[model samples]
Target: MKLHISFKISAVVLVLFAITVGMLVDVPRLDILNESIRNLFYHVTSWFAMVFLFIASFVYSIRYLNSGNEQHDLLAKIFVQVGMVFGAAGLVTGMLWAKYTWGAYWVPDPKLNGAAIALLAYLAYMILRNSLTDSLTRAKISAVYNIFAFVMMVIFVFILPRMTDSLHPGNGGNPAFSGYDLDNTMRFVFYPATIGWILLGLWISELRFRVDSLSQKMNDDLDIKSDRLDSIPRLDEE
Candidate 1:
C-alpha cells in the first residue's frame, strides 16, 4: 500500500519488460565490437548506477558536515551501501564479459584495479560506520571518512586509469572502443538501460531508507507510549 513499496514493484516489472524487449529486438552492432558489445547493457548500466549513488553519497556527506544533520549522514550511508552492491554487480558482469572477450578472468588492467580499489574504499566506509558505538561519534567519523573515500573514488576510477594502460576499453593504448564503440542502435537500448537501472537503484534505496526510518520512528513512538502509560495514576477502589 505504501508508495515506496508500489514503486519497488513497478521497478521490478519495468526491468523485466525492458530486458525482454531488449533481447527480442535486434540492434545493429559495429563491425569491431560485433555481438560481444551487447554485454554493455548490463555492464555500463550497473556502473552508471553506482556512480550516481556515489555522487549522491558525496553530496549528502558534505551537507551533513555543513549542517550537522544525522539524517543526511544516514541517507548517505544507505546510498553508499546501495552503490557498493551496484559496483559489485558491475564487477562481476565485467569479469564475465572479459572471460568471453579477452579470454581471461582477471587482469591487472588499470581500470579494473581502479574499480576494485574504489569498491574496497566504500566497503571500508561501511565497516568504519559499524565500528563506533555512539551514534553521533559514528556519524561524525563516518562523514569524514566518506568525504575522503569519495575523493579517492574519483581519483582511482577516473584519473588513474587514464594515466595507465588498461585492457578495458576507453583507456590508453587499449584496442577497445573509441567514441565509435556504441553505435546508434546500441545507444537506443543502452540509454534506456542506463536510465532504467539508475532509477531502479534509487527506487530500491529509497525503500530501504523508508523502512529504516519508519522502524526507528515506530520504536521511539512505542517507547513514548510505554512511558506515558507508566506515568498514569490509578484510582483506588473504596
Candidate 2:
C-alpha cells in the first residue's frame, strides 16, 4: 500500500512541535533531574513508538499464520526491524537519562533490565530468522516466535517494572507522569511526540516493505523466465 503524504507531513509537524515545546517549556526545577527531565519527550516517545510498531508486527504475524501469505510475513518482519531501531534509540536515551539522574548509566532497576532483555529477545528473533533456509518454514516459525517474544516483551517492559522497585518515575514510590511530573505544559508536547514517532516508524516500515516486495517480484520473474527457457525442447534428439 502506498503511504499517504499527510502521514509524512503530520510526522514532520508533530516532531517539530515536540522539539520546540520540549525545549521552550519551563519545567519545575527538581533536585537532580532539573533540565534533564526534558529527555522525557524524546526518550519516552521512542519507546512508545517501539511498542506501537511491535503491536503492528504482532497483528501482522497473526494474519500471516491464518492466511499463510508471505506479504503479511514480510510486513511483520519489517515492522519488527523498524521497531528495533526505535527500541535502540529508546535504550540510548534512557541510558543518558539514567546517567544524569541515577548517577550511573547502567542501574539495577527492573525497568532498565527489562528493557535490555526485551531488546535482546527481539534481536534473537532476527537471528533465528536468518538461520532458517526455507522461506515458508522461516515465515511460520518466525511468526510464532514473534508472537511469543512480543508477549514476553510486554510482560518485561510493562508488568515487571510495576511489580518491583525502581528509581525510574511512575514506578516504586516515584511520581508518575500524571499530576505534577507531567503537568499541563508537558502533556501538550508528550502526546504529539508519541504519535509523531509512531507515524514515522510506520513510514519507515512501509518503505522497507516496498523494497522487499520489489526484490521478491524480481526474483520470481527470473525464476519464471528460467523455467520457460528450460521448457524449450532442443532439436538434437530429433
Candidate 3:
C-alpha cells in the first residue's frame, strides 16, 4: 500500500480501537473507594500529551530564535495549537471527574487554577502570533512570547501546585503519584495511554505543518499564474 493510504487506514483503525477499549474497560476499585477512576485514563493522558507538546513548542521557539527560520516558528505554532486542544480536553475531563468526586464541577484548587492559567497563556500565544503583520516580526515576537508562556506554564502547573494546598493530590504539599493512587492495573494502562497520546499529538502537529506548507505553496502558485496572465496583452484588432 502507498504510504498515504496506509497511514490513513492505520489512523482510523487505532482511533476506533481506542474508543472500543475506552468504552469496555472496567475501572478498578481501590480499597474502600468505589469512585469511578476511568477518567484518569483520558484526563491524565491528555495532560501528559499537553506537556510534551508544550515542551516541543518551547524547543522550536528557541530554535527559531537562534536560526531565524520560519520552519521552527511554524512547528512551534502548530505544536502550541495541538497542546491547547489536549489541554482543553484535559480541562473538560478534569471538571467532570471533579464534579463526581468533589461534589463540584469547578473548584478554586491550585492545580485547577494553575492549569487554567497555563491554557490561557498559550491561547495568548496564538493571539500574539495572529496580531503581527510581518513574518519576521511575528516570528521574533511569538518566539519570545512562547518562551515566556512556557516558563509560566511550568511554574504555575508544576511548581506552584506543589507548594500550596490543593484538593488534588500533588498540590499544596500533597505530592502527586501517591501510593494510594497508583496500582498495578492502572499503571499497565496508564503508561501506554501517556505514550499513545503523546505520539498522537506529535502526529497531529506534523499534519498541521504539512497542511500549512501546502496552502502556502498553492497560494504562491496561484500568484505566479496570475502574474503570468497579467503579462499577456489582449489583441486590439478584435
Segments in model 1 whose C-alpha atoms lie over 4 Å from true places = 1-14, 28-33, 175-183, 222-238
lDDT of 2 at 6: 100
As for lDDT, the candidate ahead, 1 or 2, is 2
TM-scores, each model vs. reference: 0.84, 0.91, 0.84
Cα displacement (angstroms), candidate 2, residue 32, comes to 1.0
Model 2 gets an lDDT of 0.88
Best by TM-score: 2
User: Considering only N, C-alpha and C atoms within 3 Å, which residue pairs clash in candidate 1?
Assistant: none
Note the Cα lDDT for every prediction shown: 0.79, 0.88, 0.78
Which residue ranges in model 2 land beyond 4 Å of their true spot?
A: 226-238
Q: Between candidates 1 and 3, name the one with more favorable lDDT.
A: 1
The residue pairs found clashing in candidate 3 are 164-172, 165-172, 170-175, 170-176
Off by over 4 Å in 3: 1-19, 22-27, 31-35, 173-178, 181-183, 229-238
Tens-place lDDT digits, model 3, residues 135-181: 89999999999999899889988888787778885566554443445
Q: After superposition, how far is residue 22 of candidate 3 from its true place, in Å?
A: 4.8
Q: For model 2, what is the alpha-carbon lDDT of residue 42?
A: 95
> lDDT by residue for model 2 over 50-140, one digit each (tens)?
9999999999999999999999999999999999999999999999988888889998889889999998998999999999989999999
